[model samples]
Target chain A: MKRRLLLVSNSTLHGGGYLDHCQQHISSFFGKNVKRVLFVPYALHDRDGYTKTARDKFKSLGYDVDGIHEVADPVEAVRKAEGIFIGGGNTFRLLKSLYDNNVVTEIRKRVMEDGVPYMGSSAGTNVATISISTTNDMPIVFPPTFSAIGLIPFNINPHYLDSDPNSRHMGETREQRITQYHEEPNTPCVLGLREGSMLLVEGKKATLLGTTKARLFTSGKPSVEYDPGSDLSFLLTDPMRS
Target chain B: MKRRLLLVSNSTLHGGGYLDHCQQHISSFFGKNVKRVLFVPYALHDRDGYTKTARDKFKSLGYDVDGIHEVADPVEAVRKAEGIFIGGGNTFRLLKSLYDNNVVTEIRKRVMEDGVPYMGSSAGTNVATISISTTNDMPIVFPPTFSAIGLIPFNINPHYLDSDPNSRHMGETREQRITQYHEEPNTPCVLGLREGSMLLVEGKKATLLGTTKARLFTSGKPSVEYDPGSDLSFLLTDPMRS
Candidate 1:
């Protein structure tokens, strides 16, 4: 089976309704076959509220959204899910819950082996990568490890912001942070997905989607930019796996 | 022996030279008796370059500085040092080196038990606290643990920035990130130190230093603001310790 994934940088854009900016992409990705999406609201503290917002938005798009939290057995739910969607919030909390629920393996299998459609926004998108090391969220809690779902071979830095020459903040810029990640030996490439941008992957092909361009950082190489509709299938090639 | 510490929010403020804004506090914190300081430049990748910057600045303040990396044994370097200073870079990288060099326990003892004056800027200030959960830096690398030296009872969010109301970025503001941190049970209070602000600790008493106000966030309570010279001794009282 081939993998199908839509990884979004954010759930809501400034002045936009939840998932409003990416409605068209979300619709096209799921197509008419996926009737429902199993929502993982663990990233957020208010699971019920998160689910309601996701449920309402997906409903308008003609799909029922079932929160994995609402189910009795989460692992079984992942195994039986028609489609899987993880919402945005704190990345640390999201990864912790993913481990605590013991569905990491099941979800990986569902998406990798069974070809269930997977959708993730922000923290959700972060977990779909090899590791959450590139996430911008605070490490409020400790998970057993930083290793994530690995649905994709590389890491995704959602809401990637470029340095403002006018700003005087002393903290590391998004690019600098990703550069630091590349310092680690054998680390994978990192994609900096700006707001309103996302990656659409099907089988062995991956493409940049949405309005903005994405920055790609690979070890020992100059960072490059990819515009909308550019082929990003090279990102799916995991040297370790290949 | 009294515990002495100077935790700074940043090494260089906007339009200011390195440590130029906080020279008086650093001078007073070290006093005339401490003529030399041991520097930890592990947070940054370029140890020599970071050390040179720190060395020049401390020299201008009338102190001889030696990089810990220059010494044969980092543990011994921490033991006989008149004052210990850890410069700012990446928090994860800093904490990892602290553990990797086998000096966390030694440095903690040098400050907590031996009363050797200790100073930290940015990333350095973060590790002096209970954990690095509230840091503003990216987790570029995985440390063995989120735990730090814990010279103080709570966590410090250095280079903390207030939300710009005019900005349209959908990412969570600094305050929201700390709020998410309090959602975890038994988490310690977090202090958000704005740029140019710092904390001065002597024995059981802690005082907010520098020009800016600091925000303190305790779990299940509203955050409170503290001006310069405000008594923050209560923060030193750890519920777990006492």
Candidate 2:
């Protein structure tokens, strides 16, 4: 069997303080001869903190951190690595860099075709969707299009959470965002991921890892929230064969 | 042969404002004997000022207004209606009502199957997408779950505007919101609809209606801007056949 992919929430050493517990869920994966970590530059301006923390974590478990490059070299890095970890950042910036450099195509090949372990946190995980139309960011600086590697069919809105009870932003809440997504392409599911949550995909299996609940939205239906750590692998694996 | 659908902007009379220009477009359709209008309560509140304006406008135009409660009922109202006009109000609220009443499924049947002329303004227009995830409203309350009728295959963030350059929101501008959406799903095209803008979809034809420019984003690529009133029906139409 091929190794699984690992996407981290943040490239920061301490996991952006929000996803502090995410590391624990994947510790078992790391323990299983999973070596080599790649830090996406679109999210990391300085890999010093993230690289060091990741190195320490891996080293303590007898694993090695393979490559940390400032340039976009996803294909080469993932091709040789046993596992991959994509940390989070401004998803727009990260995706822009990936698209600009054509790294998305390459990464797709490595993870989906070669069966390399592909892991992503935050923005990294978000790129798996067909269109990131539900993200709560300005569309001016970034393009208003969404495309993905197709490892998964649905789009993801990572770092998703319910509205802050005290937020005065005067905008729709997280649930509202997903509903709007359904209004467009009602079939593609929108995964609203909360902090410390990780969606583990293996072949056709997807497991939600973390404390917060994951919300699922389908077209014309009300959104439903599932408990943390649910077996959502059905979403990843194609049901067509069944 | 089936009559074509006519999507009007806001039904609310603007009292001769610039937005009132849409009336010319609406009248053009009526000139062809396209009668019977289904007023979408999905976006309008009975108590709202805009709703009153829309009612008055329809009456003045000599067209009968059928609320969601009247006509053949929501289903019959959709099927028997010669035209469908989704007026503007709070799009989120309207979407909520649609989801609550299960009217989205019916509207979809009418427009996609029955070929009812579907017209909308502002919030009404926003719901024409696969999902209404792009409206510019804050999700004040979470609907049972957020999803809208997907008359079109993409997401639309209506009421798009450049920052006032003077007003201070002190955060991401409208452009940024769409950009972030691209980073996540990176597939469905996100359209920024400014005031007076409309997208006329006839069979396989999608004509852009308005004066300002709209922006587009694709995965891994830089964002691009489009001038309004362009015949970019290809964006919404099926190029393979049309």
Lowest lDDT 10-mer window, candidate 1 chain A? Answer: A233-242
DockQ of each: 0.75, 0.05
lDDT digits (tens) for residues B168-187 of candidate 1: 89999999999999888888
Name the Cα RMSD for model 2. Answer: 11.7
Q: Which ten residues in a row have the lowest lDDT in candidate 2 chain B?
A: B9-18
Docking class of 2: incorrect
List pairs with backbone clashes in candidate 1: none
Q: What is candidate 2's lDDT per residue for A1-242, written digit by digit as tens? A: 34254443233322243334655656676556665556454554345676666667656655677544643565566567676666555554566567776667777777777776776766677675554455544322243235655567776666565765754232345676566445542346667775555677666667776656777766665667878668877666532212
Query: Is model 1 an incorrect, acceptable, medium or high docking prediction?
Result: medium
Query: For each model in turn, which proportion of the native inter-chain contacts is also found?
Result: 0.68, 0.04
Relative to the true interface, what fraction of contacts does candidate 1 keep?
0.68
Top model by DockQ, which number?
1
lDDT of 1: 0.92
